[model samples]
Target: MPTITEAYVDSLAPNAGAIKNGRDLIKKNSFPVLNESPDATLLFGECNGSGKEPYRCSVDFVNEASPVFRCSCPSRQFPCKHALGLLYARAMGSPFTPAEVPQDIADKRDKAEKREEKKKDAAESEGNAPAAKRKVNKSALVKKFASQLEGLRLLEKLVLQLVQSGLGSVDKKTVQMIEEQAKQLGNHFIPGVQAKLRAFVHTMQTEGDREAIYSQAMEQLLLMHSLVKKGVSYLEKRMENPELPMETGTSLEEQLGHAWQLAELREYGRAQSGAELLQLSFLSYADAARGEYVDAGWWVDLSDGTVRSTRHLRPFRAARALKEEDTVRAVVRTEELFVYPGEVNARVRWETATQREAGEADYSKVKAAAAASYADVVKQVKNIIKNPLADKTPVMLVAFRSIDKTADGLCLRDAQGKLLPVTDLKTNGSATSALIALLDEKDLRDQAALVMFSHRLDDNRLSVQLMSIVTDSRFIRLLY
Candidate 1:
């Protein structure tokens, strides 16, 4: 590592905040400069953070690696402070190399200029040198296409059957049928076709005239059928000869899936557990008409994808809760992993668990399981609430006031404070054993703090809440 002098650090004054943040991170944890490119003047760094995934930040060194981009934290300011600090660190004498600017960034800048030039050359035409491109096996694709077509045809038949049964409209049952059919098709191969169909259905709901909507769907289906028929023969012949254009759908899935999967792969469930999530909360102070941004959540890095773990915070220090939104952006390694399921109308369940080790093992007697330590339980609980595994399964009772009144059922409350009575937090059919186990864990016996639970009942409905964990303490243990 080269020694970065105080003089070189002065050059990053424009990005002082970033420099400070990055340096602070280094003081507590090591974030080596990961990569740098001389031509693009870009530098990248990977940070050490608590989560299932690591954090990465990049600075445009040519632009003075002044903390232009950060992927872990929630703040949106460009050149995040972390990036700045890293560049400053590197400038001082880090052993980093400059490489060719990555194509994506370069292409991005190139397209911007190209669009501008189009105004001067309206008739402009250009082509790169022709190269032999790998051909897709049309036969295999046709077979896959035929299978999906059959599934859709079955779905269409099912829809017709519903109509025959005097179904006036596409109701809940019809949608379920459609979803099931879509899921089956999705399992067959094409990944995003189901989502596309769902989107079409949503669009149909917006426009009046159910018949017209059905007609439109029929047309789209026909077009799909026709496209398949036209390409099948050529695809089959090409497959035998091994020469054809690459299939479009596969790339689309790869591009979209890669981003989503990459984010999923990096998520570390244990990081959000314990006191951190319980105590973690945020506030937004905004001066409208100026620029306004709030700290949403943390970011976690998994093996393949990057996830931005965020929480919607009620105005804690501010006058009121400001505007909040969630977005997934693979363009700059930022993502919002859906922790709790049933987010739109239903409650989602998110939980993290950390196991505690029992100190001594009993050799003579059948070895008794060691009780989990309170600290370990608390940690696990935090992560669970922070980044839950599924957004579909709702847990029972998010928070409970006291364990004494077991009959005093926990009520689900909306943001408007409407009380939604629930039969059980764990729901019917499925035993509430898991919920009870988490609640009865001896680790929580000592602290009378707010307890958060994912209340589930028989149906798909779920309720979440933050209850008073302690009768004495002033603090509200955020149940995430």
Candidate 2:
């Protein structure tokens, strides 16, 4: 029963296809040979397949934290559909005959135990010394900084030229020219900036309100311009001190596409232990420009009021190869939480986590963390939005005295009568305002909620999008 929950089963799936296929196997009762070891630590089954012989699968829970999934199917995917189906069969209370552990499974477990024991013996032999620090090649890093600087110069000039020409005049020929320039940025050690350039071209090609498209495209250019300036200065500083370790968590580093390792963040003092978190809202979107699917979640750290995010990006090219993240409908207790670099709502990652259904006490913890006043939140938003390199949309939890419809639009008011208008922004296409309008005004009164503060590019005004509302009895999630 260690990994019997639906959530755990969902987590094992490599992609949505596996979940569907696994569920289909259960519904069709494809497993005529469902057997569980007497101790309940091993589960093995034979699932009927297209072939004459059934595909043999087994899930060994010897190490409950990381169950071993072995299948005889030709598929390269880990925990193939058949293996997942075996787990599903147990979770669903489908009859599994009690039997002794199969010889093959027992042999594999013994081998794994021996390998683990050897690793422990080796560590003990060395007196458990810490891992050596990853060596940095000073010369290569200095050259990379130099290349980045050159890329910044080239991009700065390109952005200026595009601005002068204006978005109105952008055409097919211009896009082709831009495409070639974007590819050239790759050679200069600035793939992050290159992605932005490519995103600009993508925006122009998209069909939408011409003004809206132009607005979005112009925003992208503004960010590129900001990155060019900041990147040049940032790299110049690094170029001066090539021996200096890379900055841990900063907007410039994030924009420059630094793939942060957990160990690296720990080295820079960005890692912490005993962090409790509750997911307030979740959303998934396809990033067309980069050809990746982004599964983003907004979580409230129970320890502090600061909000954090976990983004699991699965590239389109490796859709099946990577494990896709699903919405976590429970509270997560992580052993160590690693924070990524950013000014607000910094991306975060964790290695080990224990999840449980969020209870009322957890909700109270989140409610208590909401900002005291709307004015304070507005001030914070203003400072962050002004910086082009900062995350334009920051998810914040606010304590609202009341929700009302002013002549201007739907607004959430604080106790002091300061009102924050709620509207859909170009960056977040989800229309939370429309959803709010359908609900009774009384239901929105006197509540703590998680809202995304966004700067509308079309009109350049600050706006709020409701993500979730925490009431006295229930947590109402408006977005997922």
lDDT of 1 by residue, 341-411 (tens): 22211211133211111111211011111112333433443444443212222222122222332354644
Q: What's the CA RMSD for each of the models?
A: 22.0, 2.7
lDDT tens digits by residue: candidate 2, 1-480: 464766668877887898999999999989999998999888998999999999999988776546788888899888799999998888798998999998888888889999999999997976678767778787898999998898889889989999998988889999999999988888987778888999999999999789988888888999999899888888888888876777654667767866777767888888998888887788888898888989899998988767899899888998767888776766777878898878899877888776667788877878788887988898999998888888878889998998888898888888889888887765656767778867766668888989998776547678898898987656777887
Candidate 2: pairs in clash: 249-341
In model 1, which runs have C-alpha deviations exceeding 4 angstroms? 1-80, 84-169, 204-243, 247-480
> What is the Cα-based lDDT of residue 186 in candidate 1?
62
The TM-score between candidate 1 and the true structure equals 0.26
TM-score per candidate: 0.26, 0.90
